[model samples]
Target: MDRVDLLPPPADAVAHRADAYAAAPLLNSLLREVAERLPEPGDRPVYRLPGGRLLRVRGERRPAEPEVRTAGGWRRVNHTELVKLVAEELTRHTGLSNHDLPAEMLDSRDAVAALLAARDRATAPGDPYLRSEQCLVTGHPHHPAPKARGGGPVAAWLPYAPEAHARFPLVLLGLREDAVVEEGDTAALDALGDAPPGYRLLPAHPWQLDLVSCAAAFEDGRLIRLGTTPFDVWPTAAIRTVYAPANDLFLKFSLDVRITNDIRRLWRHDLLKLRRTDEAVASAFAASPGGAVWLSDRGYRTAGFAFEELAVLVRDGLRDHVRPGATPLLAAALVEGFEGSPLDTLEDPAAWWEAYLRAVVPPVLAAFADHGVVLEAHLQNTLVAVTDDGMPVQALFRDAEGVKLLADVPRAQGWERLVYCLVVNHLWEIAAALAERRPGFEPWPAARRELARHDLPEIRALLTSPTLPGKTNLLLRWTGADGAAARYLPLPNPLAGA
Candidate 1:
C-alpha cells in the first residue's frame, strides 16, 4: 500500500494541482484588470504582455521582442526578441534595470536577425516562470576555486553535479562558518547537472566573495550536508531572512544594537503591531463585496526583525509611470523627503495639496474604511506612483510595523495616539511637503471628509458587532506621551478562544 501510494500522487494531490491550473486564469484576469486601469501614458512606449497586459517603459532602452498577435496570443517574431523581451521584463520587474546586457546578443546583426526569425517556434505559453528556451543564461555562476585545505576549517569542500538539477535548485556556494570541515568528512559543494534546453547559471561576482557560504547537501529524507549558518559571517545583527522558491525578495538585517536604536526605540512599545496589520487586512477583506484587492502571494512578517516579501511593486510597480519628463511623484516624494531632497519646489501650494489629496489620500482612506480599519498611511511609509502628467495611479502602503486598526481598540483615548500617528504625523508630513509648494494648501477638511465616509458605517455598527481583536493596545504604548511607565489599557486576550 505504501509503494502504491508513493508511486503516484494520491489523486487528491493531483486534483489540488489541477485546481491551481484552473485558478491561474482568474489570476491572469486580475493582472488584466490592473493593466486596463493603468492611466494612459503620454509619450513613453508601452509594451503588451501575454494576456494584453501592458507596461510603460523608462530609462535606457534595452533590446525587446518583436511580437505580433496570433490566434492564441502574442507570438514572438524572432529568437533574439524573444530572449531580449524576457530579460527586459525580468529586469524591469525586479528593479535591476542597470544590469549590462548579455554579450551573446550584442555586436552581431546576423545573430540578431536569426534570433527574431526563430522566436515563435522556440517559445511557448503557460510557462509563467519563463521556463522556455527564451530565458536561458549561458555562463556559470562566478565562484572561486575551493579554498586552500588544512589550516582554516577541519574539512575539504568538494563539488558534484546532481543527477536531477531542479531538485537542488538552491545549492549555495561560499565560505564556511568559524568551524571548518574535518579531513574524513564528506566535502559539501554545489553540484551542477546537464544543461536543460535553454538555461545556464551566471557566475558569482568577485565582490560577492564576502557573502559566500558552504553549500548544503541533502539526500533521502535527511541532510547529507550540513553548512555553516549565515550569522557566522555577519554577526550581532537582527536579520530578517526570507526565501521564496520563485519570487525574489528583499532582506534587511542589522546588528541587534542597530535595530534597538532604529526600530525598537519607537516601536518596541507596540508588541501588537504585527498582529494588528494582519487583523486589519483580514477585516478589510471581510467587509468588501467580493473581497478586497489583495495579494494572495505577498505580505509582511517579522522573525527577529521586520521584513516584507514578494513585493508586488517589483513586478507591477511604477511600470506605467515611466514617461519622459514625468517623475514618479510618490517614489520621488519618499526618495526626496526621506532622503532630504525635494521635487522642484512647487511655487503653488494649493495646486500641490489638491493633487496630494485627490491623487494620494482619498483612495487610501476609502479603501481603509471599506475594510473597516485604519492604516498608518504616512508619507514616509506610503509610496504613490503617479502618471507622467502628475496624476496618481497607485498607492503602496508599507511598514506593516506601523499599521493599526481602529476596531482593535476601545475608547477615544485608546485610539487617540494612533490617530495622531496616522493623521498628524503621516498625513501632515505629506501635507507639509505639499505646503512647501503651495503655501496656503490645507487638506484637513478634505481628508477628514474622505475618512469619515469610510469610518461612519463602522462607528454606527460598532455596538451591534462585537469589538474586533484588541491588538492595538500593545502598539499604542509607543506613541503615548508618557514614558514606558504609562498605564496601558487592558485588552481582551485574543487567544482566549484557543
Candidate 2:
C-alpha cells in the first residue's frame, strides 16, 4: 500500500476539516449520554435532546455534520453552536451547571484548528512506528473535549502536540544528589546526558518544564539547567511520552495541562504505586502464552521538592519486545487512519482481524482471568506489530499507571474496568474501523468466537449480555467527577447475537 500524499489544504478547508473532527466526538458523547434516540427511519438517526430539541447526525462510527430540528426546519450546527447546545442540554439534563467543560469543548475545537495548521507546516516522520505514534488527530473519539490543552494558548502547546508531528530535544536538568528522589531502574536517564559531580541527571519534557516552576530550586542550587539532549525525541500519541530512536528508549514526563480527562501529570500517589502495578502486569505477560508483550515502566526519577512536576518515567522500549521484521504501530492510529495502515489495502480482512485478535485479545483476557491483573488495554495503551504483509503478529501493551490489580479492587469491578477498556474502547473501535472499510463485514461474530474460546466465568454472561459498559465521558465531565473514577452507561452489545 502506498502512503497517501497529505498536501496542505486551503485555510478554509483546514477550518472545515477541523470543525468535522471536533464535532464528531462531541456529538457522539451528547447522543450517548444525555440524548434519547428517537424512532426515525432515515439514514441519519434522530435523537431527542434533554430540553425536547430534536437532533440528527450523519454516520455512526464517526458522527459528523450534526443538525437540529428547529421550528422552521432542520438546521446545521457548527462546532461553536454544538458546544453551546451540549452545554445547555447538559444543564437541563443533569440540573447542574459547569462553566469549565463548555470552555474545554471550545478549546478542543480551537486546538484541532491549530493542530491542523501546524501539521500542514510539519513533515510527518518516515518511520511507520513514529508515524503511527504521532497520528491521532481526532483523539478519544467519544470525548467531548479530547484535544483540549487546559485552555492554554496555541503557541504554548502546539510545539509538543503529537497530532502536529512534533519531535524535539528533551530539556536536561541536574538535580542535587540530596534532592533527587528515584526508585527502580532509572539508569537510562544517566545515558542521556552527564550531570555535574554533585548532581544527578534528569531529562524533562520541554513543554512540562515550561508549565512548571522550578526557578526557586534552580536559584538555591538544588536544581541546575544542564541544556537539552543532542538527539530529538518523537512525541507519541500520549503527548507527554517521547520516544528516543537513538537509544530505543521512552521517557514519560509530567505535563500539568489536561488533554482528555485529567491533567497529564505524574501524581505522587500513582508514582508511589507504579512499581507494584508494573511488576504485576509484567509477571502476567511473562507467564502468558504467545508473543504478546508488556512494555514495562522500569522506574522514575524526580526532585523530592517537586515530585509530581519533575517526575520522568523510564519505559522499556519497543526494540526488545517487537518481533523481528514486524513493525509496531499504535492501535489508536490504525483507527484514526494513517499513511501506512493495513486496513487501507487488506486482501482478506477476516484473516487480518483474526491475526489481530490472536495477538491482542488472549493476553488481556489471560491477564485478567489467570493473573488477577486488569490491564488498561485501551487503544492508546496498545501497539499492534505487523508483518511486511500487513498481518498483525504481536501486541505490545504499556502504561502501568493505568493497570489495576484484582487484589486491590473487587473482582467484578476489575472485570468491568477491563471490559470497558479492552472490549469497548479498544476492540469496538477497531471492529468499527474495519467494517467501515469493508461494508457487510461482520466483525462481531469473529469477536464473539474469539471471546468464547476463553473459559472465564464472565465469558458466558459477556456474550449474552444485552448491553456493555460504555464510559460516560460527557456526563462524567459535566458532573465534575474525578477523571479516574470511571462511570459507565449501557451500550447495545453486538456480541450478544453474534
Candidate 3:
C-alpha cells in the first residue's frame, strides 16, 4: 500500500521527553517500507524537503502523478519530479548527498535520510499539532528556567473556562498521578493569577478540567517538568466564532491554519492598506475635535482559524441571549433622526451609512492614529459595543495579525491574498456602509488612489494606483457630492488639499 509513516520516535527523539507523546511504531514501519521501494537502494539520501517527501530512483519506473485542487488552482507533479524536488530539498537541508556516504548504501541511504528529516520535523518540539494530535497543546516551557524552589510541594495550574461554552468547566493543572495538592500549591496559583488584563475569569462549568497537573508535585515524585500548555479552541476554516471564556470578555476566533507562506502573503498585501488607513484616520482625528477613537490591530496572525471559531460562537451567543431589534447604535441614531424611519429599518441604504459613519467611522479613524497602527477595518473584524443608553461607547478591534505598519510594505513577489482582504473585503464593507448613507457615493477609484497614497506610498509611487473596482462607490459621494443639490450633508475631508 502507498503510504507515509509520519510519527516515529528516534533514539534521541524530542518527543521521548514530552509527556503528551509516545512512540509511533506503526508510522516508523510505514516510512521504512516506503524507503525500501526506492529505485537505487544504496544511495545516501538528503533530508527535510520543504513541500513534501521526494526521492529520485535511477532505474525504478515512476508512479503516476495525482492532480490536487488548491486555492490557486489545480496543480499536478509526478512522483519522479516530486522525488527530484525532494532530493534537491534534502541536499538543501542536510548539505550531504549519496557521494558523501559510503558506496555500500548508495541506492538506499539518501532516501532514508530524507524521510528521517521530514519525520523529525513532523515530530519536533514546536510541531505539537501533528496528525497524532489534531488539536493538542505541548507541555514545554518556552521561557527562561525558573530557579528550582525547594519549598513545600506545589503544582502548576492553568485554568481555562469557556464562557461561550455555557461556562464550561475549567482545566486545572495537576500532577502526573492526578494527585491533589493540599497546601504548598500556592506558588502555582501565584503564577497563574486570575486572568490576563482586559480579560476576566469565568465560573467553571462541570465539564472543564477539574484539576491541573503541577510541576511541583511531579518534581517531588522525581518527574521531569512539562512546559506550559497554551489552551486553545480549534475550528475549521470558513467559520467565524464568538468566544466568551469568562468575566464578560469577548473574543473572536477565525478558523484558519497559519503558515509561513500565508504570513508572507498577508504582509505583502494587507500591510500597506492598513498603513494607509492609519494615515487617513490620523488626518481625520486631527480635524475632528469631539471624535472618539476606533481600536485597530497592529500585528497580523493568519486569522483563518480564529475567524471560524468566532463565527460559530457569534451565532450561538446571539441565538438565545442577544435582544432582538435592539441594536444600541441604531437605536440612538433613531433618536438623532426624529423624522427618519424606525431603527429596525436600518437596512435602508442612505440612512444606514449616515448612521454608520456618524456613529462609527470617526472614532475608528481616530483610533488608527492614536494607536499608530492600521486596522483592517472590516465589519466582522470589528465590534461596536454600546452603553446602557444605547450610544456607541466602545469600538473593539481584534485580529492583530491583519494589522501592519504603513512603512512596511510586503513584496508583491509573495501572495496578494492579504491585499485582497484589506483593499477588497474590508474596504468594501466600509464602502457599503458609506454608500447606504449617500446613494450618490462614487469615489471608489479616487478613494482607492487616496488609500494607496496614504498607506502604500512606496507602491503608489512605483505604479499608478489601480482603479477602485466594486459594486458600491463610496469615495465619489464623499469627494464629489454637490453641496447645494446633495440631500445628505457630506463631511469635508480636512486633509483634502494637503
- Candidate maximizing lDDT: 2
**Residue range 1-498, candidate 3, lDDT tens digits:** 012233346653332222111111111111222222334235423222233443322211111222333466545543233434334443553454532111211212222232233333442212111111111121001100001111111121111111011112222222222222111112222222344333222212111112222244335642222233234332111112223322222222222221111111123233324435544444544444233343322222111221111111111122122233332221211211212223323444443333334444444434433444455444434444433333334333444445444445443411132333334444443453344445676535444344443343333522243332221111111122231111211122212321
Runs of candidate 3 with Cα error greater than 4 angstroms are 1-167, 174-246, 250-344, 363-371, 386-394, 406-423, 430-498
Quote the lDDT for 199 in model 3: 26
As a TM-score, model 2 comes out at 0.98
Superior candidate under TM-score, 1 versus 3: 1
Error of model 2, residue 27, in angstroms: 0.6
Specify the poorest-scoring 10-residue window by lDDT in model 1.
139-148
Instruction: Return the clash pairs for model 2, or none.
Output: none
Ranking of candidates on TM-score, top first: 2, 1, 3
lDDT of each: 0.30, 0.91, 0.28
In model 2, the Cα lDDT at residue 35 comes to 84
TM-scores, one per candidate: 0.35, 0.98, 0.30
Candidate 3 TM-score versus the reference: 0.30
lDDT tens per residue, model 1, 1-498: 000121236544433222222222212221222223245455534446534545433211111223444667645444334335434443544444422222222212222222223332342222211121121111000100001111121111111001001111222222222212111111111121222222221112111221222133112211122232222111001122211223222222211211111222213334324444555654554443311122211222121212111001111122232333333333323312321123343444445445555544454445454553555554434454434444444444444444555566553533444444444435544554454444565545555444444454443332233222221211121222232222332222211211
